[model samples]
Structure formats: C-alpha cells, structure tokens
Target: MKLQKGWKLLSSAALAVVLALTGCSQTAAPTQPGTEATTGQTPQDDGGQADMTAMLRLNLKTEPPSLDPPKGFDTTSNEVLNATMEGLARLDKDHKPQPAMAEKWTVSEDGKTYTFTLRDSKWSNGDPVTAQDFEFAFKRILDPNNAFPSAFLAYYIAGAEEYNTGKGNADAVLVKAFDDKTLEVKLNAPAGFFTHILTQPTFFPVNKKVVESNSKWAENASSIVTNGPFKMEDWVHDQSIKIVKNDGYWDKDSVKLAGINWFMVNDENTQYQMYKTGQLDKVSSVPNDMKKQLIDSGEAKVDSDASIYYYRMNTKMPPFNNVNIRKAFALAIDRQSLIDNVVQGKQTRALAHVPYGFPEPAGGDFREKGGDYLKDNDIEQAKELLKKGMEEEGWTTLPLVTMTYNTSDGHKAIAQVLQEMYKKNLGIEIKLESKEWKVFLSDQRARNLQFSRSTIPADYGDPINYLELYVTDHPGNRINYSNKEYDALVEKIRNTADETERFKLMHDAEKIFMDDMPLVPIYFATKIFMDQPNVNGIVRHPVGTTDYKWAEVRKK
Candidate 1:
C-alpha cells in the first residue's frame, strides 16, 4: 500500500518513479533473444548526408544492439531492418505477404518445392542483388555455428534443421541458386504460413561480399550496405541513427520521406517531453498519466499487440516443482487490478497464453474459441491449493520464492503490485530481483531464477508459435516445462494439414500447458503511443510493429 501510494504521488506530479536504468552491461551494447550485439561509439561524418525536413523524426525505446539480419530479433532492430532491408516478401497493411525482392514464384504439387525469381534490383552501394544473395543468406542462418534464434522458423525447408544441428552435410541443405536470377527451395513439408515466414527480418538477405570484405560492415552507419527504401547515412551512439532514401531501390519512386532520424530515448518521461517540445515527431509509448489525456485529445493512438506478458515458473526448482503450487500462484494474481491500477494502458486480462486477436484458419480468433482457463484472484481456491500442495510435499512451511525481472520503471511497478498480491492472497512472500536486459535473458534461459517475468511475441500469426514454446525440446522453453501429451499435440498440429484438425490439436496443446501451470498468464499487451499530427501513412500493426516504408510526411 505504501509503495502504491508513492507511485501514485509520483504520477500525480507528472514524474516517473526514480529507478536504475542502464544499457546492456556488456562492454558492448546488449543483445536480445534474436538480435546481435549493439555496441558502437558515435561516429564522425562519413560524407553521406540528407536534409532534416525530409526525414521522419521518431524516438526509439532503446538503441538496437545490432542490425545484422540473422541476429536482429528484437523490436528496435526490426524497425531499422524493416526500413533498410528488402526481403523476398514483406507484409502488407493486412499482415499478408506482398511482393518485394522476389517478383513471383511457384510451388510443386507435392508442396515440397518453391522456386523464386529475383526482380531486377540493386543494393544502395550499386551492387546487383542476385538469387545467390538469398541462397547465401539462408544458408548462413542455417549454419550450425551461427545458431540464430529464429532459425527454427525455417525448419520447414528440407535439411534446414539438419544443417542447423550439424546432423547433415551443408551441401544437402536443399536451397540452391539455379542461375543469377532463379532460386529453388525444397521443404520437408508444406507450411501453410511459409510466405508469411519469409516476411520476417531474419529472412532478409545480406551482401556476402560486403560482409566478408569488412566484418564490421553493419556496425558503422555510412559503410552499412543495404537494398531497401533507405540506407544508413549516419549513427551517433546513444544518440540517434540517420537513414536516407536509397536511389537504387527497385521502387524508389514510391519512397516518400527522403530520410528518417531515429532518436534513442529509453526514458518514457524524456520521450514524452521531447514530443511535447517538438524535438520528436513520434514516441513508441507515452507516460501513463498522459495516455488518457492524449487519447481524449486525439493526439495518441492505442492498438492491440499479439503478445502476452507472463511469469514462467522454474519447474525444475523447488516449491514450484509441484503442479498444485504453480496453480496456486497462477490463480492468485489479480490481472485486472494490475492492469487498471498499475499498467494504466489499454491492455486485456490474459486467462490463457495466447492473445485474443490471432487468426484461426476456419474463422474466428483463437482466444474467443478457447475461452478462459483460469479465474481471477480466487483467494479461497488459491489457499486451498497451497495447503493441498504443501500437504502433498509433506511440508509444514513453504519455502521463500524469488521473482526476477529486467530493469524498467514500469516493470518495477508491476513487480511490486504482484508481490503485494501474492503476499495478501496466499500469504506467500516473494523476494524481488532485477537485472539488466541481456543478463536477465541469460539467467532466464539458464533457469537461474525461481520465477521470472517474461513475454512471448507472436513470430507469425499462428497460435502454434505460442504453443511451440513449451515443447519439451524448444530452446525458448526456459522453464524446462515438459509434458508428453503437450509435446505430441504440438507435433500433431504441424503435420495435420486439415485446418479444423490443426486448431483442435493446438487447443489440446494449450490445455495441457495450462493444466500443468508452468507459467502464469498476466495480460495481453496493447501499444499506446503519441505521434505528431502531420505524420501520415504510418502503418501500426496490432502485431506491435510499425512499417514506415509507405509512410509519408506532408506539410500541414
């Protein structure tokens, strides 16, 4: 209660709670699950320049660690990669695949072969982009040594997983360049969402020559070679990255803004102030106190994200090793209270792992069909479960549990609220711990914490991505959760071509996941942001991503 009062006082004063904030503590910049190292110092000018007025000005939640496609897994790097690199396909406003680098293609009747023909395109450095570039980039990502996080998404390609795991020869890895313009791929099985998979940044091509000639090619702003709507023109570490329109882009004529200036402002208050002072034209998020006011005035926008915030229990660790104990914790959390009092953003209470908006092949949303799996703040049931779990374990007293999370003001507030909830409802005390982003991920992957705050963003539009997370062998299954039935259903969903059957398998897998109570579902997130009035054509997807390729800035 005291902490909540203090936070309310801070908000009432238009101030954020003072919290420790630091970039990834690596000597270099931090790296997220699917991203590269983000370490670089501000660079002096390298001759490339563009007019400021012609550039779109926006603020970044944090500076991205690396822009290399294979390692660009996080949202920050995705923003730059989406703008500066062209994949074989890109997502349209409706989140459907649209042609980009590849003009057209065909698949074999067996649904195992794909042939892609490259369009006439050149890199920003005037080098030709060929079918070999795509072939090389794909092979590089599948290389066992690289171990890119999203490499599994490409496992549908014949020999991809084998090559990635070093179980098969690289030469047998099915992707081949038939000519300067034609590329062929053989898949192990047909993936209904394969085209959408190509739209991911990890599938974007890299110039083999540029990467080989200079290993640090992507680190420097000016030397970075790209084949997209814009090219990196300048980068000042911890300050901003500047990109300008690429004259050599295949569809350069459609490019609206000549450039974009992306400022790295991790502090929410600083970002809001910059927007207010006209130093920034847009911010990815706004202060909670200002969110409603801005929305009421039509200066802010809110959109749902295909994401779920949850807490993964360390099943391999004590106390949580019992399923009933896990259920007790899951049932005790007051998701509505957390959202209404703490988050104060447009967010929906999450009863299941998957968010509410993801599409189902036959028709409606996944969450709508599955319905709620757990009730809210069932204190009596929670206490009963805790008592039963203790009795089962033959313990007279419960052990102390520690909850860990990455550092952020908002996260701290959320953690505090949860701490109080558990203490109040279950009489179980939770010790809180904080670490830098990279370290936090490292610990989570190693299962070094008792309970950890975590989230899974949908890699594609499929519920399988969420279901696959807890599969016995999945690397993303950080909690070491495993159930034979759950694993079998996940595999069944992949091979079951029938949409109805696949949906059933997916639901069954989720049911097993929830029954085990390996994780506590908190809330489905929403993006609430503020943008300058004149900014037009910006595409904000409920996926929590922004596509600026077609964005236009016009004088009002």
Candidate 2:
C-alpha cells in the first residue's frame, strides 16, 4: 500500500468491482508511441560525396534464432528482418506508422476493415511484389502448424485466433488479396493501433511464390527475396550476415549506404576490442564491468528501449505455486541499486511491466498513470510473505529451487546478484543454471524450467501487447498463469472500444497480475552502446528494432 491502495475486490463467486466507464468508440487518430533516443545529431551534408561503396559495420550479441520472419521473435532476428523486409506500413523515425509497400490505405467508417493499395515494388529477385504476399504472410503467422510465437499479433483479425488454435479453417480468416495491388483485412473490432501493430516484421509480406518453392528461402542469401532497402548478399551461419543495398527496391533512390556487414559477437569485451580496433563501427552491447566508465566518459550512448527485464516462475510447479512465495521473491531484489551499480545502464527502475515510452490509450504516460503496482525491495514484507508461504505449504524444509538464465556475461552477473539478495532477504538459496539460448527457450516453452530469467520488449505501442500474453494458454504465456478475472479484464480491454475506459481496464488487469505475482519485474531497458563518429541516419524505434534504411557513412 506504499503507492496506490490496491485492495482485493471479491465476494465469494461474483464480480467485485463494477467498471463505471461507458464504452465509446476509439478515436481514429490514437496517441503514438514515444520514440525518444540519444539522437539529435543530424547527418552531415556530404553534398553527394559520401562513401557509397563501404558497408557500415555493426555487431550482434548472438546469432539470430531464425531469419524467417514468422519464426523471428527475438531481437537478433527481428533487427535483421526489419532491415530486409517491407511491411504494408512501417514505423518511421517518429514511431508513427507510415506507408511502405502500401502506397495508400483506408479504414472503414466503423474502423473494423482496412484496405491497402500497394505500390509497384520489386523483390530483391526482381519479381513484382503483390497483395497476395501479404495475404499469405498474415495467414502463415496465424497458422498453428508453423508455431510462430508472435502469432498472437494476428489475433486482431477476425477468426484468426480460431484458425490459429486449430478450431477454424484457414479460409475463415478474413484477410484477402482482392487483386495484384489491393488487399483487404477485417478485424473482430476496431483497433486504432492496428496499423502500428502492422509495422512489426510479423506483418512483413514475404514473396508467396518464392516461399512456396523453397522452404529454406530465408536461411541463405542465395534463396532470399526481400523488398526492403537491403538484400542479403551472404550469411555465414553463427558468424556473420552481409546485406547490400537492394537496387530493385521500390524506393531505391532513397537508400544511402552500399550495405551493412553485421558481425555476431556475443562477448561484449571482444566486441568492445573490435570497436576500438576499428573492426566494428557499432557494438550491440557494452561490457557490464566497463559501462559506468564509458557512460561517464561520454564514449557510450544511451537510447530508450521499450523492454522489461524480469524473472518468470512456473506458476503450476512446486513452492512457487504459492502466490505469497512469488511475491516474496519479487520484493527481495533491490532494482534501483541493480541498475545503478551493477547494470550501469540509464534504465528506469520498473515498478510496473508496461514501462515508459508508451502512451495510455486515451493519452498521457501509462507507467506514470498506472502508479507503482509492485513494491520496491520491501525486505520486511518479503520475509513475512516467505514465512507465511512456507507454513501454508506445511513444510519446515522447502523444495529444491533453481533459477535459469540463458548464457551471457551480464545474465550470469545478474543471477548471482539476485541469488545473494534472495538469501539475504528471505534466507533462501536457489541454485543457478545457464543454458544456450535455443535450449533455454525450448525449456521455457516446455515448462521444464522452474524459475527463470525472462524479458519482454513491447511488440507494439499498446499496453495490451504487454498484458495480453497471459490470457489463458496464449503462446507467449510461458508461466502457466491463469486467472478468470484477469483474462476477462484483458478481453474487455481488447474489445472495449473506448480509449480511456480500455486503459482503465488494462491498469486494473495489471494490478491483479502484480498482486498474484507470477513474475518479478526488475527494470525497463535502455540501450547503451558505442558508435563510430561517422555513422548517421540510424533510426532506432523504441517500440521496434534498429533501422538502417536511411543510414549513411561519411568518408573519413
């Protein structure tokens, strides 16, 4: 009760709180997501004398899980996909959706239907891009056989969830390509952020003809067909991927650099050395040990990132099945100190999962308006909760516990810090385990892991993007959390139509989730990295991935 007074609203077997807000239609122009970055440095005027042959070199911390847009849910893959693929709409530097493949579009007066008019764009293979590509892409993402984790992004389309969950036929999904250049999509209801959500790579149109002919079209450069500013020239598996400017692109004249050579180097120290030696123009991460010094010396840049680093406990398993235990674990960590002393990124201490940089549906900052849902490092409360949970489980001795995280220097350090905090606060010693990224994600989806490190970067601007995954058995809901009330609140938020009322429902849902404490949120992310002096025009969207579409390099 330190922040907002969140009281339980229940009376045996009925609804506790009556939502007073009336439903009103969502405004046609919704508030856009925030896109504040360490940017104001404009590109230098080279008077058409900029180097056109050089590739702007950069590093990725790890190899992407897959280059296929449907399977590419992680940052590593989507960062590359965002550069190579063209969606009907793309978020510009302002973080507002703008026309890309689609030259123009219209929303029905009721706002439930969308019609896109495509431009004459050519794929990297010189094939003309058609509306069919989009129709195929949308259905492909929602296809259960594909098992794409981001498939929920398509649930906005009418009948999509039914088809995705194997209950309805593909033909029932209401998205169709009327002709070569026109496509139509009908949603279950009006979502003002529909276009904003469409800006994601999951919505990027793939060449239907190419994909039908080759299953591994995105795996290698030779088989790839992209319609964006760049085309893959070579891919060396876990080593590197090189992309060159696509001359066949619809707006090829706007592209500046000849290409981008993305090197995969997971070790931050090695990447830092490479950047120092001029082998890399930009680094994906800063060594945790050296971050404070780098930030203090003005050598590193901090940009706002809409990501939340948290811990997920399997709600169906063991001692954590107790709500009090989950809340105890959550309150044990000192998030401010973790960010200030250990992480050393200018990240915001997350009191809620929605994070900053997102606008509430009606207007105003969501995090600020939501108030603090989770308590900050209340050691006394944590101890009380732990004792209560242990007694409630009828055990003087606790079950064996473990915390799992994927392999990374920073991750290992964070786990160690958290382990010590838990021991100090609740007198619990949890074992720590590290696994390779693929194995880690596999274990998480299988529900084989007990307690694990988890993070979520908002896929779109809406707060529901952060809240909806927990809906009963949603693909992204790996924690096995299910509550009838919370699910109903989210369902209402999705279809409510009234922006302010919807936001209230979202906030109410989050309050219930935090009170249940299935997961522990640590801090919201801010990207801290170093860049070469000559690099320019890189647009890093807070809601999406880094874009090099308008990037250029000045001859030094």
Candidate 3:
C-alpha cells in the first residue's frame, strides 16, 4: 500500500503499511493521550512515583549551529527545535502523522493540494498562531536568498522551486493563507510522504511579527517565542541551554517534563560520568569500550536508528575521483568487525545504502528487496581495483588521502579501525584528521575533505528520502556527487505516483548509485543511551528528534 491517510503500520524486520489512496478525505484529528492506540509515548511503569518537579538533563553533544528553524540544519539544532516548536503535523509512536498545530487537514482528489484547519494555539509571547504565520514561513523557506537546505522540500509546492531557484515570482508560489485559521497549498505533483516530511524542523512556523521587529529574533532566548510545549529560558552559548515548559501551550497538560537542560558535552566519557553521578538524567553518548558492558548489564538501551553511518568520498577529489579507487576503499573496510569490536551492539552492518524501516508495495523491507551493495571484506578485489584506478589516473603512487571525522571517542575508534583496514587490505596509508563539530560541518559542507566519516538520518520515512540525497548539487549532497542519469531517475521517482513503479525505479537508482560508489556504506546506526530508571516517556523517533513532549522524570 502507498503512504496515505488512515494507514495502519505493521512492523516486520523493517515496516509493513496498509493505506488508502484515491480519495479526498479529512485526516483524523489529534486525540489526547490514552485515547488512541499510539499517542507518541507512554511513561515507563517502574512503580516509581512521578516527580512533581520534572526536568530532563541530557547532552546535546555540541552547540546548535542555529536556533532559527530554517537554518537549524544540524542534528544538535534539530533536537532543540523539535522541543521548542510545533509543526502542522507530528508523528505518533507508530510513525504515523497526527494533527498538531492543524486540528485537521483535507487532501485534494488528485493528492496535489492540502487544506489545513489550524487549531487555536498561542505562542509563548501571547500572540495567536495564525495561518498567515505558516504562509510567511513557507515563503521564507523558499526564498532564493535564504538558501535554506530544506528548500527542496517546498519544491513540491507549486512554483516553490521556481522561486527558490530565482526563476519565478514569490507571489506565484501556491501556498496561501485563506484566512486567519485556514491554510491551503498546491503541489506540482503528489508526494505520498508529504505529511511525514512535515514533521521535520524546517516546516515549523516562525513568528513573523517578532522576526520583522528583530531580524535576529532566533538568536537569543529573550527574542524567541515558541508555540511548542517548551520555550527557551536561557542560552549560554557553547555551554548549556535551558528551556522551560510553555505555560501558554495549547496542549500543556500532555507535556510532563517541566523543562530540559541541554548541555554541550563532546566527550563520551565525561557524559557517561555525568550520568553515573546523577548530573544527567539520560546520556546518549558513552565510551565505546563501555557499550557492550552497559548493554549486557541492562544499564543501557539500544534502539534501531533509521540512519546510515558511512564515509563520503569526495567524487571531485583525487584518488576518489576514480570510481575504482572509491569502490576499492569502500570494500576494504570490515564493517562487521567495526560494529562488533568497536561500536558494539549499538549498530548493525548496513545491508544496503538505504538503512531500513521503509516498506515496499508488496510488504517487503526495502533493504531486503534491494540486497547488499558492496562486499565489505573483498580485499583481493579491492587491491585490484586500487591498482587499476592508479593506472587509469597514470600515477605510480596514490594521491595523499586523508580520512576526516568529527572529534568524538567513538569516531576516533572507527577512524583508527578504517585506517588499519585500508593498510591491511589495499596497502595504502591515509592520514586522519579530527575537527570540532561546528568546524567539521562547515568544512564538510564546503567539500573541503577528501574522505570523511558521515552519518545520514532519514528526514522522513520513505525509500526515496535516502536516494534523493545525491541529486545534482543538492545542498545535502556534501560529497559533491553529480550524475545526470541518477538525477533524471530521481526526477522520475518524484513524479511517479504508483507504488510498485516507484519502488522499482528506486531499486534501479540504488544499483546505479552503488555502481558509481560515491560513498562507502558502513553500518546502520543505533541509539544507545543510559537512562536513570526514573527518567522515562522520552519518545525518540527513528528519523526525527528525541521528543520531550511526552516525557517525565519520576521521583525515586
């Protein structure tokens, strides 16, 4: 079944979905907790009393690059935005879209238009959230000068791409505010995962009045006003941030935690120590050496992450510019060993470039259907490919290649392992470089690294979400990979409405992508965290942010 309204999800190794199509129907309204089968999350039943003064203390890992929703491109900023804002729709525990700011929405007969009736909601600053807010926000995302990384998403909205690319007038973009409460949108084509993607950070509405008054409204807590369950209380740049529960929230009763104290701690060992000493309620990063012990002792929890942990080979750079060299380097790594000995049970060897949790029309896992791409330990083939690649480049010695990773204990471990693997398999020595998170992201976006360790989490639930990353010069395509045929294939997939045909095209596209070998597939990431038993109800979606809306820290 195609992704649509009234869909029921059945989980297998990945996902199984049954949904309705060919209809103009009003989506189900959001129900209060305990009223629906999946209401995002349920508090853990450890027989502990609920803490009256509830606050979750966790590490954000790094300073968020931006608090402005459209510019909050990194995961650190994504988490902060997820807690501080609300979008038209929010994903339930089952990964199904539920009414959020919009009380209900209706789709057009052709599935290319959507009309949303927003519920009565107020910002922390006491302004009423209106449809005009959404209208302004959508256009702000598509403004060519803004260059928001997520602008491509709004391209589905009729004329949005034209405006974003400076080829059309902004007034012609098919997003409009019919009134104070009603918003309408027209799409160039049907996008089945539209609602799913709406849960992303960039889709959240911004306060136009506040922004107009202060261009840097999102720069500090004093100027920011949020419509979500929480609002920023304080931000001490690069140190810590404190968000307090928004008293004016429309659904304040459902929000359990009083606030979240987000600390910026880069080292896993320090984070784990903080957790052990009760300075933190939950810690997502811990020393790699302690992962298995913690998991085995039931001190930590491991959840599947719908993300790919891989190395991006700059296709425009030397050595990797040769397809054979790219494949050779990709196939040299022992991914299973990396997972088993280093990352522990926190990850599994990725079977394909697409991580998991997407279901095909015939109810099979997308990964299972596509099969594995590169042989992880193909040493002889890797050596041969390296020789041929060097020959093709007319070089007696390979170019100076460096593997770069963001500074982290686990990342350092993985880089060391890969370095040894390359030396053992391809008889090549490569340099390793580490940078701070912010610097790393900046340099990577600039395509400054030759080979870089990278992890990509799905922006939405769908097979195409992963495949669309390599589209010609996409902002997300940091590796600078460009292939006209692959770009055309993605275009065909985007325009296609049929489930079987789309999946078939996606498979073909993946084959082409793997054959080109722009990036090396390492493993599918897993969320490994140690939480104090009393800290419960935090809903961490496989694709999106770790939600604090339904969370509570119980009294011991």
Per-prediction tally of clashes: 5, 0, 0
Residue-by-residue lDDT tens digits, candidate 3, 1-556: 2232222122221111111111212221111111222333444667776674777898998889888888887788989999999999987766678899999999999999999999999988999999999999999999988888778877778998789888997899999999999999888888888998889889999988987788889988888888998999999999999998888888888887889998999888898888999999888767776677777777776776778899999999998889999989887766655665567754666646887667779986788778777775677888899999999999999999999999888888778777766776677898999999889988998888889988888888888888888898887788889889999999899888888999999999999999999998888777777777787777777777778888888877
lDDT, candidate 1, residue 99? 83
TM values, all candidates: 0.87, 0.91, 0.91
Query: Model 3 — which ten-residue stretch has the worst lDDT?
Result: 13-22
Of the candidates numbered 1 and 2, which has the greater TM-score value? 2
Candidate 3 clash pair list:
none
Shift of residue 338 alpha carbon in model 1, Å: 1.7
* Candidate 1 worst ten-residue window by lDDT: 24-33
- Candidate 2 lowest-lDDT run of ten: 12-21
- The RMSD (Cα, Å) of candidate 1 is 8.6
**RMSD after CA superposition, every candidate:** 8.6, 9.3, 10.3
Which parts of model 3 are misplaced by more than 4 Å?
Answer: 1-43
161-253: candidate 1 lDDT, tens digit per residue = 788877986788899999989999888776777887888888999998998788788887877899988999998976789999888999887
Clashing pairs in 1: 29-39, 34-73, 35-71, 37-65, 38-65
Superposed Cα deviation of residue 532, candidate 2 (Å): 0.3
